[model samples]
Target: GAPVTTALDMSQTQALTRAAAVGSAQARAGGDVVPSAPFLIASHGLLGWYWPVSGKLSVLHSGQGIYYGIVPEGDAGGDNAHMPKSLWVVSRPHNVGSNADAKTARRNFLLKVDASPTEDVHVSEGREELAAVPIASVFTHDAYGYANEVLVADTARGDVLRYALDALDGAASGGGRLPEDDEVKDAHVAMHLFTRKDHINTLLAGDSHALALLHSGGPSRAVLFDKECAAQASA
Candidate 1:
């Protein structure tokens, strides 16, 4: 039998379309790969997508965009087609850091990237997506400058994160906090590599919000909540 064809009206085009991707706790954690759109909050933007071959995240916008991708491998880039997703969510670290040498610089970077309730700063669990290539971020900024050829994989998106850092903020405590300028300047970044594996392996690993929970104190304690999209395994 032949299928019937019909045209959509202007109203239909304007209407919000339900996401085609899957979203469930098992799906998010167990899938090990991002096969479809699940949790997405266009309102909270800062985006990028993954590349399986190289295992890195890339941004389409320059300057202000920071905190590249977080999708893990075996999930992203596993398909081998290596196509970018349409969109993604970006998250800034709670703070940023800079130093004369690698030791100090890494410290500053983690301060901003890690979360702590004692700091009064809140963590925003990233649960958004565009399900397409060329993902972009809405609020991330390059306060420290861009990096060069650094690579990382976003386990959540099954993609990689990439950026070029030119410099670092004075203190790691509030490092991920972008300046009021909305753009990066005098960044003075050097070549270094930061990967999701590094993130997961270290004490500062996991989502920015996850770090917040780890550092929360007393009433300011951190807690997890359902993002509502359903893909999170922990959820």
Candidate 2:
């Protein structure tokens, strides 16, 4: 016996027909002047998904690696807590070998984004670059929601590196962009090697502490690190 089609099936058939018609029309239109339904925001390879900030969606390109963290614009408990100020992106070159020089590698970037309530969201061209290949990064902020420090986990080196945001900001004096291959190297405020055998995969930051997730052959483990202890060890 012949199968009977239901209403749902009819609707699905209609949708497919419509989509095919649209596709044909787009092809006939030379792929340039096409229907304006879904707008394209960016064309670069996207690493992270769109992040919501102050009622707008923000996007980061894949050029900044596969990891990123948002910095708040205002105090955590204030009215503007929903707004975002900047994005710290882990910028590692595509297909870079593990043996690449970490000290001279052009990695890590900070991009400033406008999150004002009245204006359209805009990502600034000014970027600050660093010379470390960190797999994961987390931002730590003060009560005012201002990011003071950033902690990065270098999986290849099995180390956690900390850098002061203020110092990086200061390095970019004129146009908020760091010079290319400058003589002054960006210094890490503190660094701690977790384990040589097990590498760190992810890093998370809280008010006064941090967490590192490690990967091993047998079993994975999470380590809680005290900020004070890390600072003392670096000293």
Candidate 3:
């Protein structure tokens, strides 16, 4: 029998194809050729693919999902329509497998990469440190389709933190000074939004009005957080 061959396309709907050699093993032993039958495995499957701009691939420890959103042009520039977008990635270091320790000394990171039109771009990691592990994240937007804030859910702390987009972009650009200035601050402040007893696995933001947090460790449930509820709680 010939060996099985498999191919996977991450972006395609029919993602996987497995081909098995036809005819008996004795035919190949007798110096005979045989064709192969290809079978398609069909299902609703999701796969993620990333192509690094650089030739090297950098691995993230306990890396979660990658989110894309419009970068709001707040105070940084007057042109709101032409503002660039960005990619948000969250990672929790020292939080998975045998290397995980309860007393591990490391900081979780929420990284932002500017998706500029031109080749000029920079990657920014938030300096506002979180000792807890971040499990999921999402970007909330305003009415004009610009990102308002990014919400990160840390299941280790059982809470969510919201970071303003303007502050994040400002810190990444180093304001009006040189980006290499040590005097330039990169710490983006985060506001504590809410907490939960169950572990949050994912975050979803609705059309400028609502957010949904999905909890999945125990009894699965989703909690909706609306703007009215947030305003009321703040009051």
Candidate 4:
């Protein structure tokens, strides 16, 4: 059968088209909620979700049946309005195959670092690390208000950054682990906040930098994850 194609503005349109085919095959069984996908979005066009397995871009939704729209900024085009040239991943905030106990648990923010497979990252490794610095402050903050704490990531990826950013010292030792760090020594200074995500949009919204602690079966001590990111704009 002939494939459906679109004349999208994306220069990588052909590549993305090929990826869609891959995504359809990898779609998990049933509609179970997924926390995150191992694939990272390569769209890099203002916004789109990408499954690492197939490297396909996903349509973005604001949830509540609303899709995030692009607002063109004069010559910069639609991508200008949103954060352009950033890391992204496909995340599922609902449904859990193993942890069915959670319907609305933390959405999984796929990883920015293309490490080993999800299975390998989970059992093969013991600890991981992720570090990010906002090049600027968010003009708008979430209900949690200004995220004001450093976190040690737990999941094997970035989807959990926002959730973990608010806590100074706490760890989720099972699913995966991130090295916990302290709050910024200079609070007065304006910088990007280190955080986590439980959804696709959330992952793309925050600092794009993230790492994972893959365990290939070791003595279970502690893994170290850290990094600093700076957006072009600063608050």
Query: What Cα-based lDDT does every candidate model obtain?
Result: 0.26, 0.46, 0.35, 0.27
lDDT of 1: 0.26
- lDDT (tens digit, per residue) of candidate 2 on 55-133: 3333434345333344433332344454433344444444354444556555544443333322245343322332222
Model 2 bad stretches (over 4 Å): 1-44, 47-64, 74-81, 95-99, 103-106, 115-147, 183-187
lDDT at position 115, candidate 4: 23
| Candidate 3, lDDT over the whole model | 0.35
- Using lDDT, give the best candidate's number: 2
> How do the residues 19-110 of candidate 1 rate in per-residue lDDT, one tens digit apiece?
32323444667655654422311112333333443444332322222443332211124342333232222343333422123222221111
lDDT of 3 by residue, 96-179 (tens): 422233245234434443322221232222222112222122221111122566655545444444555555555555323222
Please report, as a residue range, the 10-residue window in candidate 3 with the lowest summed lDDT: 38-47
Ranking by TM-score, best first?
Answer: 2, 3, 4, 1
Cα-based lDDT at residue 60, candidate 3? 18
Instruction: Using TM-score as the measure, name the better of candidate 2 and candidate 3.
Output: 2
Which ranges in model 4 have alpha carbons more than 4 Å from their true place?
1-9, 26-202, 205-229
The pairs that clash in candidate 3 are none
TM-score of each: 0.19, 0.53, 0.41, 0.20
Residue by residue across 1-235, what tens digits does model 4's lDDT show? 1112122344444565679877865675556445345332222222234445454444332231111112111131253333323221222332333223222333333222222223232232211322222211111111111234322222222122333332212222122323223222333222233222311122112243432222224321111222233212222
**Pick by lDDT: 1 or 3, better one:** 3
